[model samples]
Target: MRVETVLLKDYTTLGVGGPAKLWTVETPEDLKRATEAPYRILGNGSNLLVSDQGVKERVIRLGGVFQTYDLRGWVGAGALLPLLVKEAAEAGLSGLEGLLGIPAQVGGAVKMNAGTRFGEMADALEAVEVFHGGRFEVFRPEELGFGYRTSRLPEGGIVTRVRLRLKERPKEEIQRRLQEVDQARKGQPKKKSAGCAFKNPPGQSAGRLIDQLGLKGLRVGGAMVSLEHGNFIVNLGNARFEEVMALVRRIQEEVPLELEWEVWA
Candidate 1:
């Protein structure tokens, strides 16, 4: 394991945050060392909001062997979701194409049940291997208690790997499906912003509600709601963490939608 002091802004898609001490763990020994101390998991650095004051605990990131994966079976927790989608499409594997365009790592995606209207991570997940309570244990989908944009990964458990069950489709067909999903995602903003600021809240669309409330283009200091998508709050170059949170609070006051991203306060 190795440690570094860094500006947390550089690690998030939002381009905001303060300084922190980060620890990158490689093998099980490294993970064990990290577990021995109080640390927070850094998952892909997307869909997160960190306070400008930063965090007190050491941040843990998975690396080395944990970044590796197998197409049909076990996959490292640190595997990139977009890469997984591309590999699945190229390998003629179906199911994962629906998650194309999501910016996330395997562990984060599963922990939050990440997905689009096409499907969620729970749809293809079979089981997971996690290290907790001084030992490694396997947890099945039934035990996960998966929900919309949420999952129970076992308290204090660090996900090491996961197993997926997918169907075989024609490679060309899966590739085409990926393209379609990408096109569907074109409406998402290209600026620096955490994917979506709020969950859709059952059958109602959070974005539509925010738009209806005329909250788009709203600004709090350097942070502003995206003109293209009401669900996104973009960083106007120098947005601070609290500036973004201010807008989040404003949106919640105007609507009942809950946050889709994590707030490191």
Candidate 2:
């Protein structure tokens, strides 16, 4: 493992951020050491929003051993979410169908409790493997206290892997369901994006609210509110972090001012 300075723009799906002090780790030993420093573990960079000023602390990104996937009992948190879901589905495993469109690694998904209409990671997660204070621990779902778009993984605790308990279903049925989810995702806008920009409110959808406010196609520099899905902010090339932030702020401000509904960024 080595530490270096890397631009966050290249790593994040949004393609809008400054350089960050970066560190790359692979083995559990490396992770244990990195956790001792002021660091943030980043995976896939899907739901993350880095400041224009860039992340100040050491940002640790897992690779090599950390990215390996094992479905027997535990899976690496750094493994791609799509890959994990695909493997599960192929093995006749149920659950994780709604996460087909989500672009993130397992660790990030667990931290954010990422999910969609069908179900969430919390529903399938049996336990989470975490490294903290130079030791590893496995926390059950109840201990993690997962909820809507959030989890109770303590701050500074680095998720190393996740153990998921899946049910055996018909292989054909699993593939069919995966295809259905994938087809639904195709209708969304095609561009570089960080999935959804804002979380959905209690009752209303964020995309619907943004569209109702006539914010589709709205732009700030090269960042634009996705015309197809208002909840997504897409980068049209050469977009800056400040532009995305500005657009988010505008949407948050206008949605409440015009619709009397508060939209948190």
Candidate 3:
């Protein structure tokens, strides 16, 4: 186990935020020991935007043994999503290909029910092993209450491992699906961002709504809305957390449609 005062920007994709007390746990025992107090479980930090004032809660990150996985569809919480997708493909697995380019870990993906239009993590999730309430327990899909861009995984529950049941598909077919997912993402901006800044409202696309409002290319300090995809807010240079939230607030206040925040701050 390791603990240090680390800048939140270094852990997040947005490259902004203040310092935090980070705890890196390499073993299950370390995880148990670190859970004695209130803490936040951070995965790949892909869909997070920390405040410039920083967080008071200690941040826990899984590592070492937690990063290992196997072909039978057993994956650790720290296992990168893209790497798991590649491994699943090589093993003739199919359900995870649609999430090819997502920058998240297995635990985070499962918690958020992360997915594209084609599929979601829930489609492949068989069981989840989480360390919570001072004990480890396995939860079935029905227990998660999966829904659009969300899951009810209990507030303090820390997902440790996940079991997936992917369909056996021809490697060629799986590769083609992955290629299509990659191709679809080409239209999105390739800049420093926490993926989509806003969640798609029911029966409507957030990008389309923002585009319809002519809000693309909007800027606040060093943060700006991506012209490529209106749903994305990019960090041009030294973006601040307040600036990003300011832009988000502007959109929410000005736009008639209610825009839900996707990035956790």
Give each model a TM-score. 0.97, 0.92, 0.96
lDDT of 2 by residue, 176-235 (tens): 888888887776777988888777878878888889889999999999999899888899
Candidate lDDT (C-alpha), each: 0.89, 0.81, 0.86
> Over all chains combined, what TM-score does candidate 3 have?
0.96
> Relative to the unseen true structure, what is the C-alpha lDDT of residue 210 in candidate 2, on a scale of 0 to 100?
88
Model 1 over residues 86-199: C-alpha lDDT tens digits? 888878889898898888999889888999998999998888888887788999988988999998888888788999888999988887887888888888888899898999
Q: Which ten residues in a row have the lowest lDDT in candidate 2?
A: 256-265
The CA root-mean-square deviation of candidate 1, after full C-alpha superposition on the true structure, stands at 1.0
Question: How well is each residue in 215-241 modelled by candidate 3, as lDDT tens digits?
Answer: 999999999999999989999989998
Give the CA lDDT, 0 to 100, for residue 67 in model 3.
85
Off by over 4 Å in 1: none
Cα lDDT of model 1 overall?
0.89
